[model samples]
Target chain A: MRDGRAISIERVSKKFCRSLRRSMIYGLGDVTRNAFGIRSRSEVLRPEEFWAVDDVSLEIERGETVGLIGPNGSGKTTLLRMLNGIFWPDRGEIQVRGRVGALIAVGAGFHPLLTGRENIYINAAILGMSRSDVDRNFDAIVEFADIGDFLDTPVKHYSSGMYVRLGFAVAAYSEPDIMLVDEVLAVGDRGFQVKCFKRMGELREAGTTFVVVSHNMHTVAGFVDWVALLHDGKLERFDNVFDGVQSYSRLFLGDGDETIEKLTSGGQGVEFRDVTVSSQKLKPGGSFSLSMSCESREALEDVEVDIAIYDTRDPDLYHQATNSAFGQRVDLPAGKSSLEVEIGPFQLHGSFAKVAVAIWTRGRKESIFWWRIPLELLEAPHAAGKNLVPTSFRVKAAE
Target chain B: MPPSDESRQSAEVVVYRPDNSLRRGYFSLWGDIVRELVRNRWLTVQLVKRDVGAFYKQSLLGIVWVVLIPLITVGTFVLLRSSGVVAVGTMSAPYPIFAVLGVAVWQLFAQGLVAGASSLAMGGDMLTRINFSKKSLVIAAMGRTIVSFAVLVVLVAACFVFYGFRGYDYTPTLGLALAPLSLIPLLLLTLGLAFYLALLNSIVRDIATMLSVLVTFLMLLTPVLYERPVVSNDAGGIASALSAITEYNPLYYLVSAPRELVLSGQVADVGGYLIASGFSLGVFLVAIFGFHLTETRIAERV
Candidate 1:
């Protein structure tokens, strides 16, 4: 409501129908037959209505850097389009305070036949900059983009890297009050990305508000101040950046279960049953104890257990270890058996998998039962509260 | 109210979203049409330039191709007249001169109509990004035709000098000089029909493919290359209806005015042409109004 706030979305929802039949057949014969006559044998398909963005509201203050993070099909892009006024919401409203600049898709306004300079004017006009404004900033934009020799060449001739560089340079220098960036930072090479990150930081300091949506948690963690997580057409969590990241990680972990009773039963010879973790405090890089249980119809010998820890934010397995390599064995009789395991200091900050269970008899080595339990690692002792400083930078005084 | 807990609490903020309000009244609606057209002016200019450029780009004769096509068509018809395959009225000027003027005016109408009809579908990429004035695309196409038509007019003047024909009494009177005035209404009618067909073509692509054949038949129906009297008395009772259609056809008046000015050396039935022009203007306005009503939904349909 305040004058300084740049953008506000209030109770907005959007619905799209599945069928386009009504708009397709436009003739007097069809209209008369459908409107006044008896029903025909051929069935007319009714369109199914689906809500792309459900009732949601948020306010973005001037100069604030906000990030939106969510899984695929989570309506993040839908919300961004509504913010950009590309798609109107079926209900509620959106108010924008100043000139809005969108880098929704890089090179979106470019024409293949037009040269770089022509595209700059056309693209800027499409982004809501008048011709006079583009004229004043033309030199600065070209210089910042650094495509000096290629300025007159057609955009189709430019490399993908050159295209993204020019697009970012034009958008960043527009001095917009609100910028909506949709995962375009991953466009250029590593060095250009670093340069863009630095430029964005400077723009933020000079009072430009940005709403960035990205699947890359590392980029979101480094750049944004606040984050909102959307899932299945609804906002799941909106708060500080770290909490939103945590909620996002949890969604990928599936519903949490203390015991593995819901897992389907009946494996070949060995049946893996349950998993559990015992910890005094769940701090990052801290020690914890784990226990696992399995049942076999017959006694099994030389059984091994494999435990792997993976950062849920990233799908790559970070650490994997097996009990057979460590000289440990499990003994199971006909009905039930239990094994105790222990590990220290979880390294990853987001979500980690605590998978452990018994693997049966040699070559075949089928799993009796396995557990894919997820555990969250909070910031370690001194790094407990809000705004934990990253360990990457060091400041020095001038000589 | 003091700054108590109730007062200090955050106020409920309201966001104002603009409704599709261009859907009301004639002038307000026309304003939207103009705004949409102006927004796409760059695209319009590019399309116009591309069209004119493409006509001359790879041709062996280049720009001369513009004058050559009409001259050849007129020459063939004049040969037909000499062989008794066609009959000519004892007009003041030679038959070639009369036929060539008719071709020039018809070319303007034909190019404008064909280009206008396809303008929307041609700029399909621009339509997806932003909503522009649909009618303006048609108008821009007509503007492109006008440029070429001006070249054709100059060619007609050159023909008069080369053939040693009597100059159509070079008069400074505004009415004689404004002989091209009749084309305005024809342009409007072409633009109106183009808007309606362009929208239709977007939905039913088959219409676009069939349009050229339809246009060819319409050209034969209009008295473009020949005089109306030749076809007025033909057989198949349909000729009477067809003659009435040609006589009342707005484009007949449009083509007749320029022919009257150049061939007969006098002003044609000005009142009749004016009425046709007015009627065409009304069609353009109605077409634009209909286009504005449906444009908002175009994005979804496309």
Candidate 2:
């Protein structure tokens, strides 16, 4: 409704000093120069200092939700800090239209010795809320946090979940013009997380601007209008959520890790040349089969073939088997060989999830070959039923 | 109540630009820092309360330590002077009362400096995540010492009454009337040093360790328990050199001037008092300017 954009970042950059002694010495030199009325350029880096965030620029229209997605230490956090004015940019300028409610880290400014109630007030004030503003929203914050009687108890006694919940509640309930959230929702329980998103949804509808930094691609795709992918302190892509996520997935795998290649000189005499999936894009419960080609350099008996599917979203969601479940016996011939494996429908929630296929020799438990395939899951026609392990892997040897 | 349409208009129009010149805003930096601190006044108060509250939260003696630190310090000197182990040659007032007032006044600045210098590092997680002015933390940490100084005020009052009963002439005069005002200069000096020390300590932590040693050594050098050493023809060696240089120690004027005013109802060395106060004011302005420039880089260092 105002005459301008909600946030504008222009060529913003922040430098970090790696060594304590060097940082101190530099600070002293700078301050001493300041004393004698000398001005120096901060854009260039000196020794032991590097740019954490380098020459980044962005702008957000009022009421838009943007997601910042990147790997650890890629400067997403540093960029957010710059946006919030926590870390003043070394070289660039930032213009914010309204107060920033930033949950940079859960309970970042919370004094452990202070009561949960006291912290809410202090944290609110730190976030640019006035005392009376906090007083007005105090009840709602307490209700949303659900701390109950623990409000009077010191936050040091609070469980991590409770601490995060209370912290999130204060920031969300403040209803600032722009809210910068930094992966705080991951700490809460599932129910609280759901509630937080629902609250965020309502806020989005209210024309509140949001810049959410998250590693969860599904959540980002669901919640944000645009996505900005950061790689190694540079913006790789700033586009619609889908394209941005695709770029991020590609970057994730592009770290000198070749996926489509022969692997594992199997001691059991069988080696897998390559594994391929029919399609990288699929709906939940969509039918897709894996095909593999391999060969045995040495003659061997009972060289049972083994295959596995590893989830990229969570490593724990893995499935491995030596025997085919579809009744066809897995046999790798002593010479060049190939197999087309078919199985049940895949109910994977993939969009950004990757499936790494691994082939192995049974009994010897020797890995034959493996490659990770980044999967893109489209929205299901109907909400796929409550299947935690959505994709099931079953293999039958080629005819 | 939720933010009304009226409150929604509080959106500030900001300009994001690259800083090509550090000199561009240096003139307005002072005004900007002051305005920002004023806006965060409530947060400053909250932080001060939290620091003072947490200090004694688990301790058995609790707030008693506020008075106890100065008391124990003054008591040790009093014992030393009375037992002849350390001869403090003086004739101003009763030794216990004279030393306690000086130590109490000195403690206000010393404690504030230590607390304020370490405040940034103490706010470890906060220094990185929150978007408030670091000036508030320095001011608030310095503010926490006021509560302990208030406790010391009560002790000083009791000392005055006890010494007055013994005919030591602890009389209230015009100088005594302005004695509390002397704390203003002392406070300015403490906070000025604190502002620079805190910023420096964030970059190099050796400032904190060095500050502790310096505060103890400086306290011994000042004429707190002992009278101002007379630098005459006969006075030579360590005594004359220390006494002559002690005149330059701002703490000497800040501590000794007000103590002289409160106990003896006299403004001893008024020119020195004015010089020290003016120097402190200069330090405060310089430190504040330096702090403004360095604060932008503080998060990185901290």
Candidate 3:
């Protein structure tokens, strides 16, 4: 609608609170403010409030399939919702031209009791398809969904695969100018997912814009022209798919080489100044010293560190942790101080892993600094004692 | 028009920034809601069909429950009146038929409100994940009630034919021809309350629970089973005070007045009934606007 640009999101930001009670109060306040025409000061973070998507500006031209790649809670889904016009930005402008067909979650609006045949019409209509459009594409969608006899059965009785297949079918058939998909594509079995991707590629050929948010690297890498990499509510990079995806993979693996990621939450005055994996090329079973130095404006006492190593490919796949077996306490002087922990004389499964380091105080209950960075774990020829994590961030309150 | 199948995927120009305050101006909200509802009309129909289908699916009685529930309710009253256990005074026709018609109309209002009020909250799964109009869910929740109301209408019609054979004047009159028009007031009143209740239900959740209890309590208090109490006589205690309070209930006008107009062509308390209808309509409009005002924020809370 905007001369081939179906989505134009400029400096968009959305904030969310974790506490349900506070969120409800904030929700009520927002509604009241909306009614009385009052705009709240949103630039500053209120208590328990954090920006989900901060200063993110992205545009999608018609007929383009773009992948949104990021770690969990990095605002990929939030950005997709903004593109779909479901969540209005707190601070910026999102102008989405033409109709948007959003399949953010699996079977988002599908009524389980409705027959697959009936649900297709409803889901299609919800996605902005006219009745005739559904009628024309009805057979094609059913065939694509492959819900033959189940077409007349209530979707509740159908398997989850059938549900997603029908849901995706209706959405794809709706043929919106822009389609927003969030991890929902992964819910369908691999075969159906391939079919969906193939179908989406064909749809893209038809002038439809596609902005997809997914954690699956292979799927994101498949056919997208560009990949927007999100990190902590910010659009870290929007690069050509190949390059963008590589960076996204690095961002995920916390592949800390030449890049420096300052740990933000190390309690205001105290911060994890830098996290260093002292190995240029890490052999999986080889020994390496991992060190983190925290600088505090205040002289912090009894401040221990909590560090974890994770498979960057999968953040949830934590390879190791310092707190669990090797708990150490260190004192940080008023000025900058450092600590080092020896890692790996034993085997590690992944060749690419990252370290999440945090500085905690008050009996390890409070953390002043936390940051994650990428580490390169090379495949070792021998799996012999390579998995050893030498105890302590040996920073020794260095004077 | 559907997009042509030849254009290739184009790159997106996404710019993430802070604080664009001017886009969501309060004035545009109503316009956006109206636009969304219009776009979602078919979604509303589908949801309604889904709801109606779900209500009877896998049940032994199935759609028969639609006719059976009303028959049992009216059947009890018919038995009570026949055995002289309960004297419901006099009506233009048989008391059982009059009572049955009133109960049928009352269920539409009571059940519609109970269901419609909770539609949004009950649809938390869909509401959170989907971008369709919330108004569609509220309207769709009425589908179950509508299905039963249709069955009730047929049953009422059958009663009229049977009574007519017995030489009683239960035949369709000019008033009966206007029955469809007469139902508009009741439907509007119930739907209006539904908009408010559905919105409120999403916020507090207790409203949904409260409504089921409230509907049951109000059903007995309303003149659905018996005639509107004789206010002229000095009826004492609960009967006297309850009659006075019931006089003001919106449901009385919706259920009692409409049934009266259909069955006997009489308006019960013309001024009071007119005022009630007008108030219900006004509330409905206000409730819709209230819903529209808060709908954007609703998804977050639910």
Candidate 4:
């Protein structure tokens, strides 16, 4: 409750060497220099070294949950380690209040030879639980873990799921004021994950501050109060969950300035020059339009256009459309011409979608021009199950 | 598992800063060291329990190895003496009893030092991912060694009882009970040196391989298996040099004082024993303080 700040990191950075042998040698030099009270050259980088976590600053208020989402090796884990005090930052400072529980790695320090019942005490102790605290909650931990018959068996024999379940159970039951979770929830099965999320929600309601690192954007958007997006070890955006996830998806699809290259040859007399979307951002069941310009060398009798929407994260086409299927024909004059397709109020709930547009002759096998465009969408609130369909529900004693 | 109100209010707050040794005053560092040790004492006990249990879990002999390792070393020396391969100078007691007692006392330091030195290297997994008082790892490893040493002491006791019943004119004085107290300096010296070595070993992989060879070489120079060599002051060349080295060697007094206490109910060189104990105490205090200052960096190195 001091200053109402649970965690504060100021201009922190950590450097790591690339070569293993050289890293150890540098460690020796640093240890020797520090032992004699000589300050290390933290300001400068040595050869083969780079900042794993660059200069970054953040402040987290008490009872606030923030999701740290970024691409691989973007310094999310490094930042988490620094917050947990596992690795000391070479520059700047970090201050944390209250008791902390870290799930940096599930089943960290578990002894393979020890039984599940025995390792619970050891793992919990390492996570900062006192003996009496563990003793008081031992039954709850066992029940939460749900590895009923294998409690007496050695942990080495437990399946990977059971192992993760036990590890997460001990840490969750430790009841820390500040919890740091790093990609641990991805290991559990669906049913167990639901239970884990329920437990996390309970903890969140109890005023536990959380810093979760995950790549699942939907989970991040739904669970966190705010989101911090990182790129190349730097904080790119810190905003509400919706905006943060949008930028993350945009980043995943590369910069939006990519020139639309044609996937098929545009024959003479009919060629597409440009394409644009009405709105890049859309809500669930929202209307949007796609417009394209065509440069004609001469008059065209009949033209057919196709629009296909592809999910950025999946391989198959999400939805496709053609003007010919709807028994529509278009006639184009010579010189410059334009065409626009209004597709609307559709059911789409994802971070980003790729739209592919192609123009074809009525009887031709291949389209003359094909272009792909990327669109960002705000996910539907409280989305569940495989499809994102907007619906309303009402009940009054079934009258 | 919801925490009680009192525990929540009393929760600890930790702050991390760069170059902590230079940032914090020396007095504050000392206070931090004390607090860290006291707070993590239970973790040390749990680590020790895990280590000792896991060590013997797969072995067929289990606890017998603790008794067997030192006896095997003593048996090799006893065989050497009987075969006339090497001469062990005259001793006041029977040779097997004499050698076994020397080996037991020596193993307390040698075994503890080896185990303690590898503590950090052996915990590379926990060190990289978890943040706790790392000194607990070294202390816990030494605790496992102490468990083994206790078994050796029982083996030594059984040897004395067997020899006495065999009518070899062996008589144990009450000083045997006080022998363990005299070995306290040896434990201190081993732990102090182990702290420095463990830190170095964590940074440099070669230190561990070098340590085993160095320990064997050091044992030859100390008076563990044979009687303390008597050399006159004017003896020239290697003899005089060896004499000077032995005189300054703290291990000599630390190892011999306890062995003499077990044999004659008295220490032959009380002054040397006191000085060795004082020197060991100084090394332990200074080394542990240095370890506390550098422990936070261990994670990065590992």
- Order the numbered candidates by TM-score, best leading: 2, 4, 3, 1
Provide the overall lDDT of each model, using Cα atoms, as 2-decimal numbers.
Answer: 0.66, 0.76, 0.73, 0.81
Q: How well does candidate 3 reproduce the true complex, by DockQ?
A: 0.22
Q: What tens digits encode model 3's per-residue C-alpha lDDT throughout A236-324?
A: 65556656665655553454464536656567677664566676456645666767676779888776666677664554755546454
Write one digit per residue (lDDT tens) for candidate 1, span A1-399: 676677788777765556555446532222223222222112222246567677778888877898988899787887886676555555667876655667665555476666789778766654555566678889978987889899988788899888888888777766666678889888788888887888788777767779999988778877888888888778754556767776776686564433422232336765555555685335665666766566777887765556676654457776787776777765566677776777755655534444443344544356555555556565433231222344677899999
DockQ comparisons of all candidates to the true complex = 0.17, 0.55, 0.22, 0.52
> For residues A1-399, what per-residue lDDT tens digits would candidate 4 score against the true structure?
366678888888888999998898888888877777788887689999999889888888878999998888989988998888888888888988888888677788889999999899999888889999899999989998999999999999999989999999999898888899888878788999999999999998888899999888768877898888887878855666777876676575564333444586366666776666688777777767877688878777677778788766667788887887779887777889888888767676645677777777766554777767676655665453224776679987965
Query: Chain B alone: TM-score in each candidate?
Result: 0.79, 0.92, 0.85, 0.92
DockQ of 4: 0.52
Candidate 3 stretches greater than 4 Å from native: A32-46, A111-114, A154-159, A187-191, A252-280, A283-375, A378-399, B1-35, B75-89, B161-167, B233-240
lDDT of candidate 1 at residue A18, scale 0 to 100: 62
What lDDT tens digits, residue by residue, belong to model 1 across residues B171-224?
A: 334554566765677777878878777777666666666777776677667777
Report the error of model 4 at residue A388, Å. 6.0
Q: In angstroms, give how far residue A86 of model 3 lies from its true place.
A: 2.1
Interface RMSDs of the predictions, in order, are 11.3, 2.6, 4.8, 1.9
Taking every candidate in turn, the Cα RMSD to the unseen true structure, in Å, is 8.3, 6.1, 12.4, 5.2
User: Local error of candidate 2 at A266, Å?
Assistant: 7.9
Ranking by lDDT: 4, 2, 3, 1
Worst 10 residues of 1 chain A by lDDT: A34-43
lDDT score of residue A226 within candidate 4: 88
Model 4, TM vs. native: 0.84
